[model samples]
Target: MANPDHEGDVGPQVAQREQRLSGLPQQVLYGVAYYAEYQPYDRLERDLDLMAAAELTVIRVGESVWSTWEPEDGRFELEWLHPVLDGAHARGIKVILGTPTYAMPPWLVRKYPEVTAERKTGVRIPYGHRQDGDYSNAAFRHYADRITRKVAGRYAPHPAVIGFQVDNEPGMELFHNRAAFQGFVDRLRHTYDDDPQRLNREWGLVYWSHRIARWDELWPPDGNTVPSYDLAWRRYQSQLTTDFIAAQAEIVRELARPDQFVTTCMALKRPAFDPRELNRSLDIAAVNPYYPMQDALTMPEPPPDAPQLEWETHSGVWAIHYQADLARAALRQPFLVTETNALSIGASHGNFPAFDGQWRQAAWALVARGARMIEYWHWHSIHYGHEQFWLGVLNHDGEPGRAYAEVQRIAAEFKQAGAAVVGLEPTADVALLYSRESKWAMEFHPPLATAAGAADRSSYERIFSRFYEGLFTAGVQTEILFAQDFDGTEHPVLIVPGLYVADDALLDRLAAYAHDGGHLVLSFRGGYADHEARPRTTKQPGRLFEAVGATYDEYTNLTAPVRCSGDFTGAATAWADALQPTTAETLAYYEHPHLGRWPAITTHEHGKGRVTYVGTLPDRELAVGLARWLRPNPDVFADRPKTVTVTSGRAPEGGLVRFVANWSWEQARLALPVAMTDVLNGTDLAFGEELHLGAWDVRVLLERPRKKDDEEGRPLA
Candidate 1:
């Protein structure tokens, strides 16, 4: 490989990243999941060639091959890896190597009892199953460190070795081992070692009263059923789980690219660990979401809103929740669709099923929202075809199937048009304040009200879904961000969704944004706490409430049918803020199912600025209408234009790239910014006019200038 200096052209390092955007190319690195179960070294080499020829430039090797790679334990096996990586690089494909963590060998889990996890029922779990490493045990880290440093340290400098995934899907399920449970207790003990009584006080449990005794008494409430106590314990367990992953990540980060990107591919339905905790240590987020209907309810036919309903279950509703998590994920840092069934599942048990063009379009929808990459769930399974839904492009024969051809065609299209779509961060008008610790803390707390209650679905998910689906469908570029994710320069206005707490830094920054005439909107749930997991009754929003021109009163938690109207629209009311309108005037209020005393939404003045709060649940109409009224953009794409999508990305060269898509049924003219060369066609187009975009055709205008720091949004090049 030629050591190319990252001067002006496509930076090789950025280009070598382990992902490529589905509709864009700067993200072209692709992965063919190569597991030990199918160690087709011969076919593997040939496959690498196929990937390169198709311009799919990445390979993700499994982390758990203990039974084979380290079959003798403590012994290293580079025999199988060296050629696999070298062969890929020989064909110009980069590789993201796993650290043998996904599945532990039977002997390792069997022999070292500490390496295994514990179930909530006090049963000791074992191996043969995958993702079974115990994070609590020092021994697990010890062994993990050895494998990581040994593998990563050796391969970090290699041209072929692009990145390392610590453990594939680290906490896919709850740790059901007593040792793992005991380890969590040990962590709590270590965190509060100085005072046992203080622990009891903070936890509101008097040990002598049998509230808690030995550490073993502390258990998470995730037995596929819930009790009040279990809820608290579950939250605690989640925090501990988070620490374990971070601890492992810290160890890996120390040895791997101090500057290199690291990410754990999240399990679709079973990513047990909080993504927020992992965000601190990760560079890119991997989104592997599943769309399982909520329950027995079938979807209504041809719904008034939303796209065509291919699914008719709680799965569709769950998909909204899934998308919300991703939308608000670490300020929505472009994530990878790490796992989507390459094809539909066949009626049989494990056979690979075929996916339709709809599936492909569904995937692109995610790309349009925020994902940086689109990685299929899997490549091959020894169980043969029909063993599982078709997650692979090739069947057991390793031959290109329909899925393979779809991906290949997509890849080729991207090759011609992707460069212009790189580094485009979402232009967020709203900062849905989300925090990792908040989620962990809330989940860990005992259930509100009483025992045997309905499950507490994430409200963050609710707000995100409403805002994301509504705004995105309208084709408005809005960002979902954490209060601390990026500076206000990235945005002129910031919308804080129900994250009611803030650190001094965030508070001060909000103050700064207000002083700079920035418009800040705080959702009903905002300003409820400080940085620490403590109530913000101190000064009511603690210290920053004054800057936002409002003070927190009491949290009025309500149920469904909540609405906010300007002095009075007839929308039903849920929860409201009994706020005293100080410098701020009331913009909207909760309507009468329960009225006047409820301030559903309010607006206030500050240093050349304004702050607004939505004190109730926002439906699509309110969200969009309010957004339009507040930070309205005059140059919005009128009449819901399709095929021609507008996007802006941060260029590796520190410039910007604006993308134009032609996802239309027929050739359509797209509004262009400059005398542009459609990177796809490699031809220049007339500037400042409507340029014809062909059906399903796309154009990328590169070398865009800096964005204007105004309401007009990122400027014309």
Candidate 2:
């Protein structure tokens, strides 16, 4: 039975119209996930009208509904999606079709019981929710390939389709199936050359009488006390997820048009796997930033007389900036926020919805940091679903609210200042090193509370975030560099935090970096273990001890805040270590009765540069002070107030776009670096003039727009 509305086929007129629409390049795209199948009302056209009114240029659909796409095995129902594409295209909106592999259909699962991922307890997870399918399962891969090809083939020729999201948050579930265990064994055999002795020796398996005699003698990593095997298991899981997404991307590429792209939404916060590896096969990096905006990155309170003092307060820009910067660093390019909040309700406990103008501030902050697109998680709230309470811009009643008003205002600004917001690259002189190896290693052997006297639960991300927050508060532009991506020659200042999993190669690189006139700041737990999480056999503090000129043979985890006073005065928490400086100078010491005179912070000069090793998790005040001491303000803004953060990028026109954002609730009056026009409001200002900003306000300034023929008009590589 052929559908009559198509008139034999989607004619050339529709194709030509879509091509014309595609010819006009947009500075940035904005929209939401349009789930027509899940909507209780039959008003998709009306919803499209609302989206058009809000200047939404894109809509993502058909990602999480596999049963609806194919009700039965080998029978696909793709016709239902035609209207969605047609409706969005009719309103000048492009669509991104998704491969429905994240969710599985009951018929397929009933036929292939092994397709589901098994929990670490060897119990197969029932398929009531998403991400239950096993990535390593052959049957799951077969169906994933079939369904991906079918959807991609059907939509590849559709002119309205702009891209394809391969899968929704892959690696969110950790699979411990039989296949994964065998895969782990194969990996171990390949790494150790089938030598059980080498594996046992490297992993220190002789302890606890856990030595393996043969390859088969090795069991799953469940309940394993050895860190090497545990680290290997995590690496294998990451590989599985990477391979799964790569397979679908390959399939989509084969069927997608040249203009179309293939990518996946990366969940960096979930900590299930590394997003860097998963993004290898993607076109552009897309991150989901549903951070606890109100409380994640704590900042000091404003003065009593500050503007909006009675209003609520939130953290600095570090939390979202860290995530987005890492996503951009993963791809080394401008990225997209595929999913952020509109109303921000649901399963997240104690989450406060956005205050008026807060949504606009957050959106513009992302754009200021090289994000080319910002799409809300959804358009309208679903009437019935597991996430029914996750409200959108439009509630279940389908009425626009304060969130929609904010989106509309932001859309107007984005349309007006297209060149200022787009094609700009975020650059930084400082880089923070992050790695999944360290995160997994720390999770396996967290700092014991008995040593600290307090039960400290700070994870690797939390500690890293604190350091980043320090730098952010200091108004230093920063970028995140993964361990694999770190290049010693690129960044002038490098900050390494709690790098629990260390190796000689990385330590050597850091030493060379410091010797070559680069500043290095390292925290506790750094250079303490190898890549496999085994303690280094050398003197305590591991391979880089010579560069740091310090050795900490003993450590303690604090049960309460321990006072530290000297050049640096503050309280330490979570963990502290006893430091014996070799050629280093002590900057601070513990003020405790028994632990007095022990170095709490040390600094060493190597070759032409410097290295600072913090022996304790310093408080926020000291953390901020350290960041400021490392990288002082540039000469252009040496006297700029600390309350205001300034980020600069090359404008599409041959000039710079400066984003001056006031992160505090109080008004910030800062001197302008140059005479410029505020692009956001078209106000011209003189150099050295004082500029005042209200609480949570952002100003985009353009520095003398250049002509199109100017050589510098081109973007920076």
Candidate 3:
């Protein structure tokens, strides 16, 4: 087995070099996952021909079956994929070859039983599932490296192969194997500078008589009760995942061509993942964003009390944009949608495919938010597997269906638009701060409770999503900023919610940002704790008290909604802070007998700017009101109907590209604010003319360059 840190005789330094792919193709790439091997019969030629007819440009292949790639240890079967690649090349379709490392072969697992991952210290997870091994184990790494080199070496030179997906959705589980635990301990030792006392003090180990006198005194995270310890464990697990992907990417890069890229599919909500850290090592970021279809995509969405579906897919249309924005934020560049919905997407019982025209709507939405490629999860539905019911473009009978027709229309549109809309730089009026550390900490010590009174582990996401949804509802575009990457002046407004695990430097920076004329909107639990998940001894909202002009020493969990009055109307739910404002002015107050004494929202002038503090989890009405107040400036698409949404971005050729959609069954019309050419229809429309939109339809319009006389302040005819 090779040393995990070493790269052959070249050592660690050379292996650590970053080899990211710089640019992608100028046009939007559209296709699906083509599994010729998984087909019931030999249909490689026919599949390629159909893909060509659909105007598909690329197909991802060979990312799932490991046993087929290597039936026995040290044995390789590399010729089976040749026909598929050759057929695709003949049809002018490109390919993204995948390394089958995520799925371990049965023979390898049987030969090396110790490589199996343990859910707990000694409880090995049962086999017959994907990603069930401790990939950090030396034995597993040896075989993984061998197979990756063989497959990539064989196909890297293929004419149709354009890139490589290193692993399929890496970081699904947190391994608790002996080697993994030892690595965690070693990480702690280095982090604390080999000082046991420092680790003890930082982790607050004196509580419950848990102080460690030596490094070895640390117990496995399985039985840990401390929040700080759990935070450290989660961070270390994410680091392990990043390391694994980085190593595999390094292997593929060595075998790949200069034109071929290397990346792994990212499921953003995976437990043991950090996208920003992981993407630093890859060429381009890729994500699988699956969303609920049908009425779930409709605007003026179901009421708050509506019965929600229990699934892994995102719930609302705003959530879909949220996922795409997050993917762009990963490396601050355009990314790929490796796998999204084709037909139905989940278990055998779950089958709700998109309504007519929804595929086009979703594809345009993703592109508007910076997607370079749009690929479905698969081309044809599988005949047998755990995902057999996860339907595709061509269903079980292998005939082109509704999904295929919709995808084909989208592909032709992408071809027509060409380089005009690809690689767009999305516009943002507000910057929202995102913290992975804070999310991990809140998962362990949640501040909110479910309706059943159970601790809500998703407390961070709930708070963040409310503000994001409010911005989307109020027609304010947002840019997501990671805490470490946030500077003072990214946008006019910076909204931070439930940032409970920030260090002193970050808190101070937020204060400075407000002082430097940035409108800072803060919510409950911001600046409450240090990076170690230790509560600050200073007043609640520790470092921002001066900038905010308000402080809270007490808070409560509400059993019911509390009405809010003053500027913002609606109710506050789940939690509230008893804010004591010294220099701040009250913006809203809670309509309660006892809680009414403290303001529900307040604002204070500090330096050149102001800070508005929200003391409770706001209902949707209040959230939209607050968003409107924060970004009061009106744009061309302001005051549109509830069913109509318009998102604009800077195109690659330095022109404004706007995506106007009516997310409803009723036709809608929007009066143009500027002269623009419809990219899809090739029609020019004058300013103030009403543009018609069909139900569930989206139109891409490019703003025309102003005439010299118009630029000199003369009115255009």
lDDT of each: 0.54, 0.77, 0.86
TM-score of each: 0.74, 0.90, 0.95
Stretches of candidate 3 off by over 4 Å are: 1-23, 303-309, 707-717
Residue-level lDDT tens digits of model 3 in 149-218: 9999999999899889987888888888989999999999999999999988898889999998888889
Candidate 1 structure, TM-score to reference:
0.74
- For 229-270, candidate 1 gives per-residue lDDT tens digits of 333344455665567556656666566654355667765334
Question: Native-vs-model 3 lDDT?
Answer: 0.86
Q: Per-residue alpha-carbon lDDT of model 2 for 459-495, expressed as tens digits?
A: 6766787788777766677877778655464567888
Arrange candidates, best TM-score first.
Answer: 3, 2, 1
lDDT of 2 at 425: 72
Of the pair 1 and 3, which is ahead by lDDT?
3
RMSD each, Å: 7.5, 8.1, 4.9
For model 3 the local lDDT of residue 145 reads: 86
- Residue 302, candidate 2: alpha-carbon lDDT: 33
Pairs clashing within candidate 2: 451-557, 452-557, 452-558, 452-559, 453-558, 453-559, 454-558, 454-559
Per-candidate clashes come to 47, 8, 0
